[model samples]
Structures are given as structure tokens and as C-alpha cells.
Target: MKLLSEVEPEVKVSVKRIDGGLEVKGNLEELGISEGTELTVVATEPVHVHAGPISLRVAGKETVVARGWADKVYVERGGATVPLLRLEAGEKGTVGTIEGGKVFEDFFALLGIEKGKEIEFLRHLPDDTLVLKIDDHEISMGEGQASKLMAEHGGKNIQVNYLGENEKAKISKIIGGTSLKEKFEQMGVVEGKEITLVRKETPAPSPKRGTYVLAKLGEQLVTIGRGLAEKVWVE
Candidate 1:
């Protein structure tokens, strides 16, 4: 009976008990970690990613956003479409594509990062996050949530959470079948959102260990703080 976070790497442990509420239990269960679930711990290292500020000029408007906001914002550079993140300062391109699916499209659409829009990587601003490790199967919200989150991957309908670690899926539909939709919506877990299973933990650590994420929507900028950022995925 020990906290997964406190466990040393390479030690095999079974989940004896999970300390928390239903939300915690549910999140752990989704990752296939529960009582009696035996798993080998791997070297856990904290990985941090910082998003720099990306200045953009959109339709005569000037705005600043976290570098993450421009990740999916594609631009035409040298007749080749590339991520907006690759553009250097003073580089300009046409909005050739808005990837990451409908939810992202709607987000970028509101920011005017759509087709035919002239975009410029005005400049980059600086800014300054964690991930637990397992058998390379980072825990992703699984089981029930995965069951409810029916996603269309490779033309097949599947639960988003049930996906293996590092497995990515696009949420095609959310069938809460009751109040789950509202619950999922509260978390912004909606269709058109792409979800990825990162890592899993035993004894079910906190649903959120406070991972920092910077999400952006083209020229429309907003800063998302921690806590809430871990639970919400941009795509």
C-alpha cells in the first residue's frame, strides 16, 4: 500500500487501494489501474514543455498568443504548407489549412485563421510543465470515459479512453447516455476533439497532477493556466 507517485522506478506493485473520490477512482479505472492491478514501474522523469509567445497580424488586427496556439495553424511557405510554428519572425503565409479537426477548426475560425486569410508571424514571445511514466503506457482517461467517448479512428468507432498509451483518436461522438454529455462538456470532452492516452499510474494518483499546457487559436490569443489545462485538450 503505497502512493504510485512515491514508488521507486522498476518496482512491481499492485494497486491495493486508491485514495480519493469517485472522480479519482473513475479516472484511474479508465487507465486500467485499480485494486489488484499489477504493473511494473518504469523510470519516471518529469518532462516540461514551454510555449513561447507568437505574435500574429490577422486582418489588420494585432494580437499575441501562446506559441501552442499556432501549432496547428498551417501556412503556405515556399509553395509548401507548413505549421505556423515553423514560421520565423516577419515570415508571412496564407492560411492554407486549419488542422486538428472541427473543434479546432471552429476555434481557429473564430480567430480568422481560415483559408485565404493572410497571416504573418510577427514575432515570438517567451514563456514557460509534467508527465508520469510507466511501461511506456502513460495513463489516459480510459474504460468508462473511453466507452462513452465513441471516436472514429481509421473509420472505426471506438472509445477514446480505451486507447493505448501514445495512441491517438479523434472523438467523433459523445454518447453520455445520461448526464455524461454534460459532464464531458464541462471538461470540454466533446466530439471533433482528438484525445491521446499519455501514461497510467497505479493506486490512482490525482486525476490531475497539474501539467501546464498552452493552447492557442491563431491570432485570437488567450492564456490558459494550469489545473484546468491538464483536463482540457485543444483537439
Candidate 2:
């Protein structure tokens, strides 16, 4: 057995146990790293692990780990594991699980990705980017963002940004803290709500200025800041 952080790149391993108290265990579990889970070491410097249906950054030289925390995560070499982000174009796999908090889960779920669903991996574009075919739609994502998904190839599961001007789409997900979620929800930006991008106005000539987005949410017209609008995922 060995600590996950100590595993070599491309090595496969099965989690034997996670040694930590409730808080520690809970945090790791949220990232999909737990006992009985199988994964592979994608990298070591930042400690990337393809845990189940998600890829995770476990530990690193700059990351502080509690005493005995990493050691508690013991693993046996050689297990089945694959990360969705690592898949090449033309490959396909089933959605296994997602690693992250409730907000992250909700975000992906709203985008039509969830456990047990089938997805086809498209080609990787420039700037560490890639595209995925989910159902009848194609969603593009960045590599860093895509690494959080886990899947099995021969048997795997695994696992968004921006909208365009003058485009109409249904609300797929929102990415932000509680306050942001509530703020948008209150503005009728909840998932499944159809919205249209009316216009993007330039920032006013003032020190406290910012760009604004005008849109139609249902029967009402709404305006949102560009920063916040970027967090709103549309399909």
C-alpha cells in the first residue's frame, strides 16, 4: 500500500482506506476520493487523481495536508480507472460520478450530464480545450474543468461556459457561491428557465462602471452584470 500522493504517474490503484476525521473524510469524499474507489495517477506535482468519475487534485508541495492525512489514503497498485478529460476524440463512456460540492453537481446536472448517462468525447481544441457530445447537444469545456469527471472506458463513467449575443437558450446551470445562486434565482434565472440575450452594453464612462447584459427572462426583461452573466450557463 502507498499514499496517493506518492503514486507514480500513469499508475492505477484502488483506494484501501482514507485515514482522517469526519471533516477531512467529508472533504475528500466530496471530491470523489474514498475507500473502495479505484483511480489512476495522472500527475504527481499537483497530485492529480482520476477518482471514479472525476479527476481531482489531492495534494502538492504548496497544499497543506493535515498530519497523517495523506498517509491515511492508502491504496493498492493496479486497478481500473479512467478520467473523462483524458479521453480522445471518437471515444465514448458512461457518466460515472462527479466530484465537487452541491453547486458543482447541480451545475452539471442542469447541463444534462449525470451518472448513468452516455457521453461521446469529441476532439480537443486549442488552449487546453475539448468538446463533448451529450445526447444531441455538443458542450465545450476546458481541460482543468473537465478533469473532475471519472469514467470507465471498457466500463467507465465521467463527466461549461458562456453564451452568445442575440442567442436564446434555456438556463442549464449557475456557477457561484450561495449568494450568487440566490441572487440569480431571485432574478428568475433558475434552471430550465428560457432566456434570450437581448444586448450587451458598454461600460458607462465612470470609475465604478461595468458592462451590462440585457435579456428577456420569461415574460419579463432583466439586466445582469457581465461578470455574473458569465457564470450563467445556457443551452
- Each model's lDDT comes to 0.52, 0.39
> On a 0 to 100 scale, what is the lDDT of residue 203 in model 2?
29
Steric collisions counted per model: 10, 15
How accurate locally is residue 41 in candidate 2, as Cα lDDT from 0 to 100? Answer: 45
Model 2 worst lDDT window (10 residues): 59-68
Worst 10 residues of 1 by lDDT: 126-135
TM-score of 2: 0.31
Q: Look at candidate 1 and give me any clashing residue pairs.
A: 30-142, 53-125, 69-216, 138-198, 138-199, 138-200, 139-199, 139-200, 146-161, 194-235
- What TM-score goes with each of the models? 0.35, 0.31
lDDT, candidate 1, 71-155, per-residue tens? 5567788889876765777888998776556765664554455778888877654221112122333334423234445666767
Name the runs in model 1 displaced over 4 angstroms.
Answer: 1-50, 128-235
Candidate 2 lDDT tens digits, 105-203: 565553355556655544433223344433344444343333332222223222222223434455444544465456445445455544443433332
Error of 1 at 209 (Å): 27
